[model samples]
Target: MLEVKLHDIGEGMTEGEIIHYLVKPGERVIADQPLVEVQTDKMVAELPSPGAGTIKEIIISTGTTVAVGTTLLYIEGEGSLEPVSEGKASETPKEEVPVLLKEKNEFVSSFNRVLATPYTRKIARDHHINIEDVTPSDPSGRVTEEDVYRFMKGEQLAENEAVSTIVEPEVLAKPISPDEIPFRGIRKQIAKKMTKSLFTIPHVTHFDEVNMTNLLKLREELKKEGVHVSVPAFFMKALVFALKDFPVFNAELDEENDRILLKKEYHLGIAVDTKEGLIVPVIHHADKKSIQQIHDEMKCLNEKARDGKLAAADIQNSTFTVSNVGPLGSTGATPIINYPETALIAFHKTKKVPIVTENDEIIIGHVMTLSMSFDHRVADGATAVAFTNRFASLIEQPNKLMLEMI
Candidate 1:
């Protein structure tokens, strides 16, 4: 019998809820075929079968939260399981690690088990250190937290590392509540990522409003031609056109060496707000799509996202992102740059604002703001401003909608 354990479906993800099982007991499954659907904090993901076999048992049920090493199913196979060697993509169950470590020493339990966590083990392996060599000082013979930490700091570990001999000073023994509450669900994930990005990359936001009356009129014209379009669809079309003239805004930041990577194609990420959280699905090759095509795509995506049918692939890989808060009557607000991407444009609610024509005649016209936030490391203030200006010009002139056709 082959036990199928939960694997890390994504980077930085440690747990997932078993949302569904595609197969039942005694079902014959093919290799690489989907076995179950797991919902992480981000999206619902499908887990594929490891090999062709008949499922013998289903261990975890729907709505059950399982960690990386938790076994979810067992399969009866014809061949015996072979031990995976180094350089193999296959991963052994967590149970195998302790069994292997026990062979080296019966006291493998003594070292702080904290270091035995998958992430810590991966970190140790990346650092080219053997976990067995590190000794745990905890009373239960389990590796104490300090042993792993000290090893990471390059402190020499004896043949048998000693657990701490002395207790902590009284000053360190106080129980204190944290000032900031821990975040849960999507908000927490967003908080952690945004904080990391904000600190790692220097960000600057540029705000500018556009006269959207022309675009509004254009949308009406399209509706008359049997095409329904949202303000976001129009914005997506305009942004795609604007990218042709301002490719730098569609670039990414290389933080490790401090450089910018300018991509040739534009894959626009449309931010969709769901009851659970926010998801941005990319419209690949958006620059090549027509206004109506963008409209249809947005409509399809919006419907799928709102209905919770969004697949994992739909929310991944975006060259740039667009956040339209204008529908909520927001005039203007700064948005955080979606990391890796150098910029994201925040759109405000479009409304009729009084404007004086070149003839000096004052009239109420459609006006809106496009707030652009960018990584200063990848783009300076001037580039961001110039890009917004191009987008603004396109929004003010309804005839530019024709530009998408050409």
Candidate 2:
């Protein structure tokens, strides 16, 4: 018999929750066939079988959390003899096995069940309503007190002949006991990294606005040529040039060694917002790619991130990072620096605003705000400001960017 064990999936990953078992006992499976789906701190991954054989026994049931190197199951291999314990099955209760399996299934399903606070449950009980009947609208899948009240009001409206009235805003603000969500998976990982970055790095933010008139015009011209360019693509291209001029921005500070590691290759990490949390996927050799190429790659990465299909390699080894909140309709944000990397750039919404030209004449122009956060330990304020100015210049003078494309 061959023992199948859970292996280490990635760095710092010690354990994983078995979301579901793809194979059952006595089922035949070939090498590389997925045996189970495991949810780690970063993403969900399918663990494959090691060799072709018939599954003999499942040691760990579904929804159970196990550490690395734990034996998950056993497979019958060639020349394997039947265990002597098979004859002693009468000693074990046949009815108990099915009961145990049912219990495990119930445990796994419980994780996805509706969650509500004690106060919210009390409100539902007082109104003689089933808490499970109420739908949760919170992103975290928790049923709030307001949700209970809304359901009760809806039912009242349907029973009475009178017209329905809007729910008062003041009622929604009533205090209630909050549900405590367990810190696990991607959300927990993000908290750990953010805490480390905030406490260890001295972050200084530089805010500036760019007149994106020429940049917008360039994008429109590209669109006419059958090339779709996004706002981030423009900033990515401009960032490449800025990094070349100011190498320090693309470097990491090795505090223990007391030296700066200036990266020769440019791997830009684009921050993607996912339902689970934020994940950054790196674009290898970004400096060598065209703006259109960057846009295409970003789309692919963003899709993978949202679908929880990103591999470990997709999120590692980034020289610099960029995050854009413009798509969410934000005007600006003070972004935190991604750890180890010296700097990060944030992009905000673009709008038409009045600008003063050289002749003191006021004219409307497309404007976007750019925010840069840098590690003071690695670079001073002047260096960060100079890099931002160069980046802004590239957007203002689109002709220079066109020349670089050649």
Candidate 3:
């Protein structure tokens, strides 16, 4: 028997919740076959089998959270075996065998064994509803406190027809306590990173407005050729060009050595908003790829991010970052800097506004506002302003990007 230990799932992840087990004891499995689905803070990934063998036992049950390097199961096979440490298998009652055998039931129903946070379970208990019956809306398939409240509201509405209700003035005047949500998973990770960035780095923001008339026309032209381009793609290309001229923006401060490390390669980080939280996926070598190539790659990365399929490497090694709030229809925002990176650029919504041309004539044109935040320690106000101006020039006159495309 060989021990199948929970290996490192990368991205500095130390622990994961066993979402479900695909195979059972005595089941013959092949190499690379998915043995279990483990949900980390970033994503839900399938842990594959180590070798082709019959599963001897499952040491960890579903919904169990374990750290890395813990024994998950054991596989029996023909080999010169070495002594391996094993974990005790979870004990289940014989009468519960029928429930466990049911393939549709992914979770093993037991005390404090539901795939939910303590807050969610508390809300469920207060409402007198089972957490298992609450439909989970999160991508990880874990029940949330909101789900419990929603279930309670639905039940209350259904029973309202059978009962009469009266509102009291004292009850209405009483202040209600706000529900506190515990920070965990991706939300917790975001909070930690944001706090570190804000407290550690002295951020200076530079705001500018760009004439996006040319960019809009170019996007239309590209759409006609069966190539769909987005605002973030164009901004990413502009950032790469600006970084080439101002390499200081594409650098990180090494306080230990008291030096700045300037990166030669342009690995642009694109911030993607998902149902879980905000995740940034890096587009390696942004300088080498054309605008169309960037668009295609960004599309694939966004899909993976929303589906929680992004690997650790997909998010690593970013020299510069771009956060586009245009999709949310915001005019502008002062975005927080992604830690370790020297600078971050944000693109706002493109709108039709009246512009004064070179002849001082008022004409309607497409306009987009951009906000860039840089670490003051790495870059000064003048350098950050110059970089933003260069980026705006590229966006206003998109022919420069078109030349690169050709």
Candidate 4:
């Protein structure tokens, strides 16, 4: 028997929601053919058949979220099959996987005869609640994520209100528009990240305005000289210098080691809003790249993000992040920091507005507002203010930004 479990495909993927199974039990499939469609926190992936065989049993039902190592299904290879050899399971007989739950039962259960996913069982274990006693709202007797949370709230099992679990993956024929959106895939992943960042980090956001007159003028000048670049690219270059001055803002808190580790390399994460959700693609070592290089690379990353073609490497290891929402027409926003990264800066709407000059004169200038959010535990407000001020100065005088290149 071939025990096919969810493979650890990428960084930070612990579990995935079974979207649908491409193949059904008792169906013969070829090697590498997609067996099941899964939606992880990162992307939608197809778990393929280990070898050509007939799918024996689907352990995890559709719409259930299970941990990485939990078995999804069993496959009977052609002729005599070798047992699973990945771990200690190799020694265990194949009978456990096929017959542990039951022959005719649709819902698979753990050794305790509890119809619950590994994650649901984990929740029960963490709270010291015996999962066997919790009444499943799923008519099939399978426990759900919400059922566990409701139980924690002192909700009674007999009054279970969790959504019905999908027992078979093949019933759903086509995607249909529904009024209520199921918060399971990317949205759920985003909620988890946002909750973790908000609860764990002490957030402090500072708002400031930048004089974009010089930067815009410089962009035009460069364009006239056949050197094309973007305004955000220039802003990113200016931020590199500001980060150099306030290195603490670019540092991550090593909670385990009880120290703040300052990062020397500048890997800037650019947050791009897509149809699915907000995705950040990193520009590694931005400090070493020119304004044109930054512009070109940022464009390429943004395109890939829109098309949903960004790979795992495109989004990892960002020391700091920036959201340029100016084109989207936002005056300011308190952007969330990519967790583990100390700070994130958002550039908002730029408009031709009246400016009060130092010489007591009013002049029309291009101005953009910025919101800088940082982990207050790592840096103080005074430091954040100085950092934004430096960024503003660099934009006010492109020559100083040019000097930063040197």
Candidate 5:
């Protein structure tokens, strides 16, 4: 018997919840075939079979979160499959086979799982109706409330005399209690990470306001030239230039070595607010990428983050991080630094406000608030202030970013 243990999938994942078993006990699977779907803190991933084998025993059930190296299941085989790098393309589950239009019973029998919302499933559960037994009226094979009701109605009819009373009592929705929710997924992992970052790092947050009057005009000009770019992309480019001047902010403290290790490369982590949690996908070399390239990559990463498709490589080795909460209507936030990284910057909502110019004339100007958090042990308040000042200057004069570009 070969043991299939849960390994680190990406971003030093310590544990993951067993989302579902693609293969069941006694089912034969080929090498490299996805045997199970596991939900890590960052993504939903499929674990491939180690070798061609019959699944002997499933030690861990669905929804159980287990640590790295914990045996999940046993395979009765020679175990010939070699492990690849974590989150390799081959590890992803195959694209679902396309199914043509089919009869209701045919569609139900062809798949092991039915597509249904939690509420729909709950309704079925309360009525003692098998979700599987309810034939979907929709072509997508989704079991809806009406479908469940239809199934209940069909079974309840005693020569059409039994109607309202039999259906009404069973259809009464059972409200799920708060205690019923098991705190054991990305939400749990986010809590763990936030706790670690807060307790370990002596956080010092500094606020800064940037005059975005020039940048707004520049963005419009670029858009007219058919060179579309987002404000965050511009901010990222400016951030890279700022990091070049204040390299100390783009560093990790090696506590064991008693030294701050300054990173030469700028792998910028853009914090994306996903449904799962806050997922920070890294742009491998932000300093090297053009504004357009950064924008394109950010779009791709953000989509992948929201869709839960980010790989281990996508979220690792970020020297510095930024959270653009402007679009989300955030005014400002004393954001926590990503652990071990020296600093993180957050861009908040911009408002057109009155500003006194160098000529002492009052004028309407666009201004955005920035909240920067840094590890107090590695850098001082003065250094953090200086860093943000440099960043603000770049944002205030966005044209300078074009000159600083590679």
Candidate 6:
């Protein structure tokens, strides 16, 4: 028999919520097959099988949060210990990921069956509602936000019994909206992580306006030959180049040791907004990819992120994060750090502005704000200023970026 333990999904991710199991006990699995889906504070990922064998038992279930090194499952049979020598590299398995619950059954009243965290359950109990009566929208039938609203309404109804008896449902209401949304699965994990991020970290933001007129002109000139370019692709390319010049921005923080760990490779994370929430998919070795390659890869990652088809690997190991709010008409924003990275850069809406040249010539120019948030503990004001200045210089000099590309 062999046990598969959860390894380090990423730095600082000590625990993850088990979303679900793809395979059941007594089922056959191949080497590299995904056994469980887990949602960490940073991203959602699938844990894979190390060897081909018959399934033995599942140690965790949907909605249960387990820590790193937690033995998730056991496999029994031939080669389970030795591991199958399949030379093929594992790809994230393709499957319809259900939201953080098992198959829906009639609601259970026991607190054990409720998928809420300790705090949520406490709130529900204080509100005097049966937790089971709250219907969950998640595939696991886990209670959600709407469920809480419903329970609260039930409490209000009990308090105003006289009005409830007189009010006719059809006469007073135009379709009662869903009342409670249960906190279960990835959504629940996202909430927990964001709450922790917001509260635990003292966040501050700095903003600057950048003139991208030259870069835009260069991109338009390239578009004639069907060499399409996107703003993010261009920004990422320039940012990577700037990082090479200003290495301090690329470093991560080791809080316990009170040291800065500088990274050699530039892995840029493109924040992909989805229906579930915001997911940042990392493009590994981003500095090495061409503009076309970055464009194509970003397209694929963003599609998967939106479709919820992303695997665990899709969301791991980002050295830096970029949150582009230009698409949403945002001129500027204060972005929260992904943590340990020490900084995050946000792209804002680009527009035209008037500029006066050294020769006393005034002309219309394009401008955009590049907002940056840094961990004060790691990066000082001087370093942040130098990094942003270098980045802005590169963006202004489109020819330099083009030459670096060649």
lDDT of 3 by residue, 202-292 (tens): 9988988889998888889888998887867888888888899999999999999999999999999889998667888889999899877
Candidate 4 clashing pairs, residues 3+ apart or interchain: none
| TM-scores for candidates 1 onward, in order | 0.65, 0.69, 0.69, 0.73, 0.78, 0.68
Residue pairs with backbone overlap in model 5: none
Provide the global lDDT of candidate 2 against the true structure. 0.78
lDDT of 2 by residue, 1-406 (tens): 6677788786456788765666788777666777776766556677887655578999998667789988889877422345323233334456566654554454322112367643355467657788889998899888987899999998887766443353557546778779886465556667767887989999999888889998888889888998887878878988999999999999999988899999999999999887567888888888899988998999899988875668867877789999998778888777888787899999888889999999999999999887899998889999988998998998899888868879
- In model 4, how large is the Cα lDDT of residue 244? 94
> Each candidate's lDDT (Cα)?
0.71, 0.78, 0.78, 0.80, 0.80, 0.73
TM-score of 2: 0.69
Tens-place lDDT digits, model 5, residues 1-406: 5678898888777888886676778776666777777767666677887755567889999888889999998876522244333334234344411221222224222125477653455457657788898899889998877899988887768536655546665656656556555465566777877899999999999998999999999989988999998999988888888888989999999998889999999999999886566888999998888889999999999987775667789998899999999988999889998887999999999998999999999999999998999999988999989888888888888767777763
Which numbered prediction scores highest in TM-score against the true structure? 5
lDDT at residue 174 of model 1 (Cα atoms): 71
Which of 5 and 6 is ahead in TM-score? 5
Error of 6 at 60 (Å): 3.9
Error of 6 at 286 (Å): 2.1
Residue ranges of candidate 4 with Cα displaced over 4 Å: 48-52, 78-178
Q: Which segments of model 1 are wrong by more than 4 Å?
A: 3-37, 51-74, 78-185
Estimate, for each residue in 1-406, the C-alpha lDDT of model 1 and write its tens digit. Answer: 6678888765346787776676788776666767786766566667887765567889998767778889999876423255332224245466665654554353221212232332233335445566677776766554433566788776445432443543557536778767873244444456666787788778789988788777778778878998787777777877877777888888877667777787888889888887556767778888778767888898888877765567666676688999988778887777887776888898887777789999999999977777888887777898878888887777788676666557
When sorted by TM-score, best at the front, the candidate numbers are 5, 4, 2, 3, 6, 1
RMSD of each: 16.2, 10.5, 8.6, 13.6, 8.4, 11.2
> Which scores better on TM-score, 3 or 6?
3
> What TM-score does structure 6 among the candidates reach?
0.68
